[model samples]
Target chain A: MKARVTVTLKPGVLDPQGAAIAQALGGLGFTGVQGVRQGKLIEIDLAEGDAATARAEVEAMCEKLLANTVIETYAVEIA
Target chain B: MKARVTVTLKPGVLDPQGAAIAQALGGLGFTGVQGVRQGKLIEIDLAEGDAATARAEVEAMCEKLLANTVIETYAVEIA
Candidate 1:
């Protein structure tokens, strides 16, 4: 099975990289961009075939290594 | 309006960061991990209300700044 994990900053967390991108977009003459927030998209190929098992394994990966947890949040999807 | 841009390395491209993550997962004792790939997820706040227009604008942004088009592909979602 394949799993996708999206890790993003929690609300109110400051994101300098995102700010830089937004500023760069403005400089590139693309108007109407008010803000930007950047995150991580991780795709994992798992040996497990069952969807439930894959989801549980991926979530454990998130808690253990995939996410910072203090400032970032993660969502996992298994297919 | 909100726009989400997911940028990923094209298939066949080597991702050292992803490899490192996979290795780390193994070190952490999680088994059955076959492989891993990492990408970027960017969320943008737009002043434009129309989804079509917002998507167009975000795509343009992707072309101009967000994605390296040579080895990276990006998808834009407007909400």
Candidate 2:
């Protein structure tokens, strides 16, 4: 099984990297952009297991290591 | 409307951030974790528009600024 974990900065968090990109975009004439924030995506290829258990484990991983809860939130997708 | 762009490091790209996290996990005794790679996710809240055009614009954003195509690939989800 494979899971994709997407971690993103919360709406109020400051994203310096994204700010830089937004500035760069305006400089490049992609002016429609209003705001941008950046975060993370982690893909995990897991061994076969019960779906509920797998989700728990992955969520633990995200909370423990993949994302900093103070500034980011994560969502997972399975396939 | 909103769209999410998930950008991840290609398999061969060196991910210092992920390596650092993996090492930290190992230090904390997450023994089964053999490897890790980190990437970026951007959530874009766009004005209501045509889905096809929104996707194209987002792809352009990813290729132009949201991701470094040299080392990453992106997937988009809309809602």
List TM-scores for all candidates, in order: 0.98, 0.82
Docking class of 1: high
Q: What digit string (tens of lDDT, one per residue) describes model 2 on residues B1-79?
A: 5778888888888888878877876777555455666777777766547888878877888888777888888888876
Q: Roughly what TM-score does model 2 have, to 2 decimal places?
A: 0.82
Displacement of residue B14 (Cα, Å) in model 2 is 2.7
Candidate 1 TM-score, true structure as reference: 0.98
Best by DockQ: 1
Residue B21 shift from truth in candidate 1, angstroms: 0.4
Pairs clashing in candidate 1? none
Per-model TM-score of chain A alone?
A: 0.98, 0.93
Q: What does DockQ give for each predicted structure?
A: 0.94, 0.48
**Stretches of candidate 2 exceeding 4 Å from the true structure:** none
RMSD of candidates 1 onward, in order: 0.7, 2.3
lDDT, candidate 2, A1-79, per-residue tens: 6667888888888899878877887788766667767777776655645677667767888888888999888998866
